[model samples]
Structure formats: C-alpha cells, structure tokens
Target: MRIRTRGYERRRRELELLIVADIVTIFAWVLGFYGLHPNGHIDFLNPWLTIVVLVPLGAHVANRHLAADADAILLPLATLLNGLGYVMIGVLDPTQAHLQALWTLISVFAYVVCIFFVRNPDSLDRYRYLLAILGIGLLFSPMLPGIGENIGGERLWVHLGSLSFQPVEVSKLLLAIFLTSLLVEKRDLLARLRGGGLRRFGPIALTFGLALAIMAVEKDVGFALLIFVTFVLVMWIGTGNRIYLLFGAVTFVLGLVVGGAVLPQVHQRISVWLDPWKHAATTGYQLIQAQYAFGIGGLSGTGLGLSHPTVPVATSDFIFAAFGQELGLLGTSAIIISFLLLIGAGLRVALRAHGEFSSLLAMTMTIILALQTFFILAGVIRVLPLTGMTLPFLAYGGSSLLTNYILLAILMRISHRSNQFNDLREGTTG
Candidate 1:
C-alpha cells in the first residue's frame, strides 16, 4: 500500500511538472509570437485562439499526469515542437500572430479529443482503421462538387464555409500510421522483403507507384518524397533490413525521373533551385525574397521589427524569411537547436517504450515531424525546390496547428508512462 501510494504521488508530481512546462511554453510562445507580429494586425482573437487550443491540452495533460495510457505523450511532444515553430513565426509577424493564435484554438481542441479517443493504446489500431476510412474519404474530397481548388496549384484542399482543410495531410498521417501498424503485424514478412530478391521488386514497385500516383495527382512531389523517404527509413528501423533501404533509394531515383518528366512543377522546382534569380518575379518569387532576407540578415540581422523580409504572407509560407530578417542566423540557429531537443526527447521515448506499437508509433511520429521540418527548411534554403508545407507548429494554418497539438499530447502521455515504469522499478512511488 505504501509503495502504491508513493507511486501515485510520484506520478502526480511528474504530471504537475508536465503541466507547468506546458503553461510556461504556452506563455513564452504567446509573448514571443505577439512581439514578432507585424504592426496593426493585433486583435482580441489571438488570446481567444490561444485559450481554445490550450484548454484541451490542459485536460489531456491532466490525464497524462494521472498515468492514463489513453492520454499518451505523442501529441504533447508534437504540439511542443509546433508551438516552438509557431512562436518562431509569431514573434516575427505581429500582424498575423493573432490569426495564428485563433487557429490554434480549434487545432488544440481537435488534438485533445483525438488523444482521449485513442486512450487505449491497445485500441490504437482500431483508431488507425477509422482514420484510414476518413483519410481515404478526404483524399477524394476535393473531387466533390463546389470545393474551391487551386491552393498553391494543388487540388488537395476542400473549402467549407470560411474553412479549408488539406485532405492530403490527413491522408498522409493515416497512411503512415496504417502502414506502420500493418508492418508491425506483418513484421516478419516486411523483414523478409529486404533480401533484394526479384520477389521483392513487385511490392516495392506497387508502393512506389501508388505513392507516385498520389503525389502526381496532388502535384506535390515534395510530399511524395517525404512519405517515400520516411517509409524506407522507418522500415529499416522496424525490421533491420538493408534491402528496403537500397530498394527505396533506387525507387526514389526512378520516381524523381518519372515525376520530373510528367510534372512541370517538379521540373520548375529543380530549375528554381539551380538559379532562383532567373525567375525572381514569378514562380520563384518566394524563394528569391527568402534569399534576400537571409542575405540582408547576414551575421546579425536587421533586429526585431526591422527586417525588409517580412513578405506579404510572412505568417504562412514565407515565415522563415521573416525570422531571417528579424532574428538573423543566430536566432534561427537557436530555433533549430530547440527542434533538435524535441527530436532527441522523442527518440528517447521511442527507445524506452514498453511495447512494439508504442516504439514504432513514437519513432514514426519523430520521423514525420523531422521530415516535415526538413521539407520546409529545405524549401526555404533552396536545398530543394519549393513546397508549401507550413513550418509545423509555426505556420499559420488551423489543421497543421491542430495536428501538432495532437502529436505533442501523445508524446507527453508516453513520457508519463515511461516515468511510471521507472518509478515502479525504483520502488520510490508514492
């Protein structure tokens, strides 16, 4: 009884710390976000949005502290990283910080509700099934009547009365989670695919073809690459197979060739990367301005509220430019360091998880967030051609913001479980 009491007390304390961290992080982002907004964009909506997002967070974190597996930590960590990104974006563009804060409200609520619904980690597979059904539904949602298409030249979004959602995002997440769960169930079969045999070629071809088809239809080569690369990496991690890695590399190369030939955007991105200044006023304008921000920032930057890099949509697609102009490389480096911390924390949780599902899920979550960040940063830096991924938590998008919140909340729940397990081992509970 004494040991159980101590265990309960220890978990209570850890939950308290989690809550404190959430509050501090939220407050810090709010202040930083407000400080960075462009002039005259201020409004009461920002505070309201922040509350809307955090309220659900408060509920789930409360559950996490109580040692609820249903509460999990995946969402917590995802949100934390996103909030970091959001804060980075917010602090540099005061004008739209309020808008981001507003979107955040709905985003956080969606995430919290999802986390609660998935409380039984054993039942996550069922949730994955439901999500897949909805994901497929959304994947074809744009084809339905009366949805305003043409977001960044991609028909991935569906508009509904003052709101828009990118079905592709939901599809990607559902597909990834579904794939991970399937791979786990068929871990042995998946592991066998790495033998480099001719038999392996068929499955690889199907996977590559299907993924290419999605990206081809979406006209988003970047998203396709992100998904392909993630699958290869995670498969190797899951099954310890070298063939998946090599096969993935070969297929990826083929994909690039096939995609570039058929898609003008794919070719255009490559051309822009080679020489952005050539198309500065049209297709390459965002990148050109982004480069200008980096160049103007130099070593120290123009300082807060002073950069010429605050592009028209600084709170969204070109957010990094705003940071580049305002905070310079030094500030940007700090943001990168924070991202590193979040990744490290995620990896630690995956390594320490108690089950295959937990471990696989945690690792995939890390990979997705890492790849997403890389996708955005690479686009911004011209390492790759441009793609329109909101910089995770930082970009001013409602769906993306909500997605991150769910991610982080799940991470925190995982962390809580790890802590409980540790406390059990230490016999210091209560």
Candidate 2:
C-alpha cells in the first residue's frame, strides 16, 4: 500500500509539472511573438492562430490524463521547442506560420493516436520486415516520375497535387522501428554466433548499407549519414561489440573521401566548408551569410526584427542562423538547453525501459533525434559540410514536426510501460 501510494504521488507530481511546463511554453510563444512585432498587433482571439498555441497544450493535458505514467519532462520540453520553432517561423515569414500551425495540429493528432494505439511497444516486432519495406519504399518514392520533386538540388520531396512533403522524414521513424525490432531479436545471435562478428551481422549491415546507399544516390547525404550513425550506435549497443563502431567510423570516412572525389555536389560542399569566402558568390553563399548572422549576433542579438539578415531558407535549413541573429548567443544557448533536456529525458526513458525491445526502441529514437540535431547544428556552424538537414522539432516542415512528435509519443509509451513494470516490481518486493 505504501509503495503504491508513493507511485501515485510521483505520477501526480509529474502530471503537475507537465501542466506547468506547457503553460510556460504557451507564455513563451506569446512573448516571443509580441517581442518580434512590438508595434504590430495580433488578434489574440483569432481561431487559426489561437489553435497554434492551444493545440500543444491540449495535447499535453490529454497525454497526462491518458498516459499519466509517461515521461514527465519529454512532452513539455518538446512543446517548448515546437513553440519556439513556430515563433521563429512566424517572425521569419508570416505567410508560412499558418501552414506550420496546421502541421502542428496534424502532429498533435499523430501523437495522440500513437499513445492510444501503440500500447505494446513489443508488438512492433511482428511487423519489422513490413516496416522496413515501407521505409525503404518511402525513401525512394521521391525518385518516382510523377510525384517526385527536387528542391535546391536535393531530390528529397514528393508532391501529391497540392500537398508536398519529404518522404524520408516518415521513413526515419519506420526505419528506427524496423532496426529496433531487428536488433532485439538478433542481439544474442549476434553475440554468440559461430562466425566472427562481421560475418554474423553482415546481412543486417548490408541491408542498412543498401538503404544508406539509396539515400546517398538520392543526394540526401544528411539523412544517409543520420541513418548510418544511428544504425552503428544501435548495433554497438545491441551486440556489445566495439568492432562494429570502429568499422563503421572508418567506412564512413572512406565513403566521404570517395564520395567527395566522385560527387560534384559533395566536392563543392567540402570545398565550401574548407573556406566559405573563396566560393562566396556561388556554392558558399549561404554559409558565408550564416557566418555573418552569427558574427552580428555576438552576445544578446540585434533584437528581433530590427536587423533581418538575408539568409537563404531562413525559415528552414538556416533557421538556427536566423535565431542567432535575432535571439543571439544567449537565446540560442537556451534553445540548445531545451534540446538537451529533451534528449536527456529520452535517455532516461530508454534506461528505465523494462524489456529489451522497448529499451532499444527508446534508445534508437533518441539517437535519431540527437544525430539529426547534431548534423544540422554542426553544418550551420561550418564544423562539418552543410548537409541541408532541418533542425529537429525547431525547423519549419510538416513532415519533420509530425515524424518527431510520433517519436516522442513512442518514447512516452515505452516510459509509461517501464514505470508500470517498476511499480509492479516494487509492490511485489514490498
């Protein structure tokens, strides 16, 4: 009885914290909007705009009431980050804000659906191959004749009449599920196989390698790298083998070298990363402009809307550079901190997961989010070649927002199950 009472108290506190955090997130959204457009007034009662802020808060309330055992901090942190992204998009381009709001609604809907339906994370194992095929199909669908569309030299988007989206965004989640299921089932076989580690996991490695190859062929290098890194990390965790990590790192570097030599786009990006000014007129233009944004935004910022740095795609790929220009170092750091909190909460869930499948699923999901964030952040700062990846949760894209929310929902569900398992164990011991 005492143990049950403690568990109930803990869940109650978690729910309370989630509610407060979501309220604070909404406040931040409003504050950011008003700060950006001080003289410009907004109709607070506007249904379209009001739903933008209220949808996430409403989702939080529903999640707490429905999935009270879910990770307390994950939803609120994601809400804050999503809200921050919406504000940045609104400031950068008012036209797209409504579209982003619509996407937010869709993403929240997906989140709710996942929480309600995917109660047993382990059930995903049954459809691993099916999910893998769907993921691969989606990744390559952008190459099809009618529906495929190329934007900014990357053939990543697909169009269906009026609607357009990056199919790989959905593919990432499906691939994560497929990989998690595969690893959990094959972990022991991988560890205790007769042949050496490489041979044993060769089929699995080749399968993912083929997917990465497809992504590379499509010129979606960022997603390819993300898939590669996530695959290698999960393999390392699942097999407890250091060789896979070492081999993967070496192979990645070698692939980059070969790719840079053979692929003009890859070569150009590498050259620009080496020195943005030399090619500033052509390939290096965006990076150079981004550098300028960071330079002008040294400490606090130029103040929102006061100085508009002309960064190409400021609402999407280079959104961080825009944030740096307006929000400055302090504001950007706060954004980073929010992401850190989110990633940390995800890792907590992974660690607390009761079953192998749930644990691997949670960890892989977190890795996917973390890797995407790192790739984009590093690219923006010129620490790595610019890969044209959207910043997770904080980038203006319906596909990305929806995919990430689904990832969060899965994490929450796994956390909820883990908490229940822990409670059961405690009750039994008591």
Cα lDDT, model 1, residue 121: 51
Q: lDDT of each structure?
A: 0.67, 0.82
Task: Give the count of colliding residue pairs in each prediction.
Answer: 42, 0
Cα lDDT tens digits, model 2, 173-227, are 8988997887777777766636654566574467457645754668777887788
Q: What ranges in model 1 sit over 4 Å off?
A: 1-61, 64-96, 126-130, 193-203, 425-430
Q: Give the TM-score (vs. native) of candidate 2.
A: 0.93
Highest lDDT, which number?
Answer: 2
